[model samples]
Target: MAAAAPAGDDAVAVDVAGVVKSFPGVEALKGIDARILRGRLTGLVGPDGAGKTTLMRLMAGLMAPDAGTIRLAGVDVSHDRDRVAPSIGYMPQRFGLYEDLSVIENLRLYARLRGIAPRRAQPVFERLLGFTRLGPFTSRLAGRLSGGMKQKLGLACALMGTPGVLLLDEPGVGVDPVSRQDLWRMVEALTGEGMAVVWSTAYLDEAERCETVLLLNEGRLEYDGPPAGLTARLHDRSFRLAGPRRDRRQVLSEALGLPGVSDGVIQGDAVRLVLREGGTPDLLAPFAAETGARVEAVTPRFEDAFIDLLGGGPGGTSRLAERMDPVRLETEVTVSCRHLTRRFGTFTATEDVSFEVSRGEIFGLLGPNGAGKSTTFKMLCGLLRPSAGAAEVAGLDLRRATSEAKRQLGYMAQKFSLYGLLSVRQNLEFSAGVYGLEGRVRRARVEEMIETFQLGRHLTGAPGDLPLGYRQRLALACALMHRPPVLFLDEPTSGVDPITRREFWTHINGLVRKGVTVMVTTHFMDEAEYCDRVALMYRSKLIALDTPDALKARVVTRDLPEPTMEDAFIGLIEAHDADREAGA
Candidate 1:
């Protein structure tokens, strides 16, 4: 907002002092104070219901704080909202783009809403289409575009008038790695032009890119500094260890309980353990004997720091069935597909796709949005009939034994897909009924799941009323009501906080140990390492398939010591594209 200010020109872009907002039964946001400096990218990082979204909305002038003052570039938003509205571009967690409209139409509509002249927006739109690589899809309906493309278009529309301040809430949630890279590049370019950007995200890797970060927890500021400052907090303590699969969890748990171990987490094939204040060499020998694991030191990353900060919340439940024989399942080939193809009119969703998932294995299906992972998932679950090809789940043909196949698989869709209107207990009861569970058995199973996930405290509340983490737990409960042997999870952890994601996977690993085969799709690259085997999908085809380490090995051209899964994913995709172009 335009206002008379002190003569000094370098004022804070957005400032909040003692802000508080409350709902009926909860204090959503406690008193909070923070400042976003001019021409820099500031990140809002925290777990679900930490009030990151609320703070962003308050600063964007979308809501009135119960008790506080918020100033944007020296002007108070509460008192001068109308004047400041045009200067701030806000993108909520779920952006609103007309599904029926074309990309061009959506851009034009936003331009008109921002009061930009048609002539002036033309060049801007051209640049946007070029930057997003959406030139060929300009005429396609928004609903037909992939998730990543829609996000890019949303950004293009928000930047129509080139607002001074930009607020993005979880902009990269379901976006693929390459598209995410493009989006961050665009953001970096904008910040170079002196635009203040406030980005909120669930992925810690995304937060690492911010110039400065404000780590919020339950409406309170925990840490505020540059990105490097957060990483510096975990300097000498982090260590990595490698051992047998069955001993991994046992080793981590025993290590955590040791006198010298402050924290221990399983990362890929190793455990990243932080030493306690008075830890000594004598502690290691007894701890190794207790867990029967071989330990070694390694470099610590941001994930280790995050787990340490969350303290003792949820993790390591996966050790439940690891002590038992993991390969004693009823079915040998849990799921098998041959030349699977699905078509909607002339468009091929998945063409000649083939893959196999073994019993008691965690298999990952990695892909960009619109790469047909969901389509293939639906076909495997018997929700959709493939146009051609044959598939069998748990030894039953999907087409011939639809109902029988459904009984052998549990599916968690992209959306939590639980009824928001139904309470947690009500949803569980309904799900049990669908699986043909009777009154007594249904109640028993429901109670067991509730206790296992620690949901007794909120079972009476509506599923929608619970936070993101609780809702995910509830959905998984419903899916596993019948104890299906194979589970299909489509972006199961999308838009969830890092801590919650870690907890969710901890439960998932527990299931895998009990001989439940899992086929999952996800956007977070770090998660790829957790799966036993991973398949990278592009343009409805499987580009690469192997263990996470093997996939990374395919892309190793240099002797870089710490090449992460993200690096390998991008590198493989690039080489695949290059080979495709040469063949074409």
Candidate 2:
């Protein structure tokens, strides 16, 4: 219905009708249809494998639809993508970046390719560098930048040609809260200047900020309109419950299973469920009592409503930690480094970095895109050797006792690395064997892990067939097959729903209670609060180290409304940028 029209806007910038794309054995986009109005930021929201990326690639003319048409500024993009290429900028989920080249070098190359004269490009590049507050790091290799900075740099490069339409696919996935704010601010500024943006993300919060949102689930457009309209769907029909926290997922599941219940999803400590028309609490009372939950009426948020619409409500919460305590334990340092150095040619990926992660504690390493967090993590995990200095994990130097040190760690990288051909049980069994767990012990652990992670029903299915959240949980289960003393998670909860993120943490927290130390790297500031301690790194240096609240209190700024971890993070980084800028 023409997307119900935004509050007050008429100009249309992107028009796609009956778009359908298919691969060798996959229907990527099933007759997809959507639009982006002029001067407005439209969000393409979907879960992974929901055709969001495919649609974006089609719109950008990087891929063609089997049956449909796409137009940019009313000109057919599918037919004349080259002619309209100069007026469109498309940034894929994984934008190609050179590790060896400096930040400014990459910008210059893009400008030249876009036909910008040296003198003209110079001014624009300078302005972009300043806008992103990355001027001082111009000479730094792109590989050495932090995750947040890398995203910003990517954005800078995308805007080099001043495209009229910008298509960004999950640009803020692994970005910190402060950087996300900066990104949204930049988008707002561009839209104000009449640029149209089609931003895709798995984060509902980011989608809520868009002028209009297109909700995609399983290759179908579920909702395409304003966020207010989406929220309005629930109205008084939504309800919430908060009492003693008691396994909200389980409670919600049972509540929904009742005759009068329709849908439910857990939100933090509460379970927000929908009731049948004219349904009353008495209908749900027995279900709540049986599920060990105290029911109450609570307002549903956008996330809860979306989950309901998608029919992806929370299932029963497994009693994974029933025998174990839920509280995190504080123990002695399990991993320590002193003056650790790693270099590639003349560039230092990790320069004289030093830190210690306590045993049984959740320690978070926070940084921008290439702030050396991954380098340090690889060193500790014995994947890479340090160029100099000492690096010890589990009381043994990784370089000297790599095998022994590895036995003490269970590592989950940025993406779940599992064979798509293998079933969930097979993957777990393989991991168990690799970790030296064998015989009955191996079989028992594998079974336990699957049960704990709720893979029983999907055990026979290939790992690739599982949902993103399930895949993540399976990876975690595989990592813990050998019951390592320490777990190293690299962006464990990236690109997942907030509810799923919380569920993942619930399991991770369970591990902490069993004297298992967790050293994690993440871009989410809210996740930082869950950490026992946090370290903010920049340019291979540890700048801030403390509990989340303590770090928030340390960095003060007048312009920021609330002094959050995000505010402190940005203020600290900005000040460092200013100092370096002046020095440069």
Candidate 3:
């Protein structure tokens, strides 16, 4: 085991030493040692199955470590959770909020659970509502709130008793950018007020904002330090290449094949690449000249360093991509929405949404929570009836030929829709049967999916038992079992690691090369770069429509750094909101 950095009287909130935890067939954590200091935010960052949640649970006293000692505020509380419970607050990934209760009602309930008297809880609840910007929605039912609002409410509930330490597990996984900003602002204020916070997040960008970061891989700690120090190691090792937009795949393939190149991704009209140690600009000159692409050195971000530290390389060939039989349809318009609108009673979920997806195109719907992206998606998939207008899939009207249109495509919901009780192979077999496959064909398809997704060993394992990455793979495999022409992916990579995300997109790109149309909705702004075009939605309306580069150009200026998709997205939404207010 490596020697952990000395805590050195820095007001350590939690001290974990030589901790090891195990499940029936897995060692969840192995010899972990770290010190979380008060008044500082510590980011727990790693790939799926890296034991982030397990570590958090241990610190929260929800679970005991099989070995080693955990000290909470200088007191050993590894087995005495009752002694530590009063000083610790834990907000799990799926926070427990009463759906039937209003926001303020839920807060009062949690306060009561914590044994706070009404006299004291009222002031705290009011302050929390203001802090979370949820004061306006105090009367709204928790279940009716958007994903971001629910997370804020959860955080407020966790803070009811003013615990000295806070542990958040992937709190921003599916949250929109604006809400993410709000959440971080609140967290920073808490840390400023001398609260120790340990946050686990899949987004490396979020980790970059932390005062300290703990990097883990497969249950072992890899690095413990400031985010800047980790990113500094990759200085001069990262570069951006700009070339013909259509040559993205070719450039990525060639770049990955280059010596010393570690990993690369499509980044909105450019490819961001990370090179191994001792890699030089001269090494890339040949490829640059061949592709007529311009290469420029760029500062590496926290994500680049994280991927490099994990030894992530170019994604291997995707077997799933190989088995994807391209769509043979002769139509140019694969998906079309003409002023599609949906309403739930008096509430308009989506309105006047119009867009067309071309064959083999990757179309993305980008928006904030409650921005009607999912409602639009459901309309296109024929799951919901549009209050107005029409949509077509594979030239079949969604309303008139709903069954036929659905039969021509595959749909994966925002949540993993697979049966938790069924084995991996069983889910695949069931999916094949739903698509009307039988006999030897069903068996062959299931086996092919297992082999393609590398789920051979987990054939008998339940889907819910798999890691986040593997579960995503299984979901995608099941969605493609029948080889549909169009695929709908709803937040397909939520809570997944960067490595797995890269690998998943590699397969998607390959399938696109073979002419498959994909309509995807995602919260990860970086993933928007992979789309041929993206539509930005705000308050049940399409606010902007264009390629990622064009949308970004709307916000980019000489005085500011190059705008990311998130920046552009926020800018567009804010502008639209301002316009609506002015019109009103």
TM-score of each: 0.93, 0.74, 0.97
Candidate 1 contains a number of clashing pairs equal to 1
Question: What order do candidates take by TM-score, descending?
Answer: 3, 1, 2
In model 1, how large is the Cα lDDT of residue 253?
Answer: 52
Which whole-number lDDT from 0 to 100 does residue 452 have in model 2?
A: 79
For candidate 3, the 10 contiguous residues with the lowest summed lDDT are 1-10
In candidate 3, what are the lDDT values of residues 1-584, reduced to their tens digit?
Answer: 11122346857888999999999889999999999988889999999889999999899888888999999867777777788787888999879999999998999899998889988888888888999999999999999999999999999999888888889999998899999999999998898888899999999989999999999999999999999999999989999888744468657866887877988889988888898888887788778878888889988999999999998554645667777666788799999999999999999999999999999999999899999999998889999999999999999998889988988899988978999989988899899999999999899988888877789988899998898889999999888888888999999999898998988888888888788999999999999999999999888989899999999999887875689999998888888878889999
How would you encode candidate 1's per-residue C-alpha lDDT over 114-166 as one tens digit per residue? 89898898888888888778889999999988888888888887777777888
Local distance difference test values of all predictions, in order = 0.80, 0.77, 0.89
76 Cα displacement, candidate 2 (Å) = 2.4
Candidate 2: lDDT of 147?
67
Predicted model with the maximum lDDT? 3
TM-score for candidate 1, please give it: 0.93
Q: Where does model 2 exceed 4 Å of error?
A: 1-10, 116-120, 235-300, 316-363, 367-402, 415-430, 439-477, 497-503, 509-517, 529-584
Could you say which candidate leads in TM-score? Answer: 3
RMSD of each: 3.1, 6.3, 3.1
For residues 220-250, write the lDDT of model 2, one tens digit per residue: 7888898878877666666656553454434
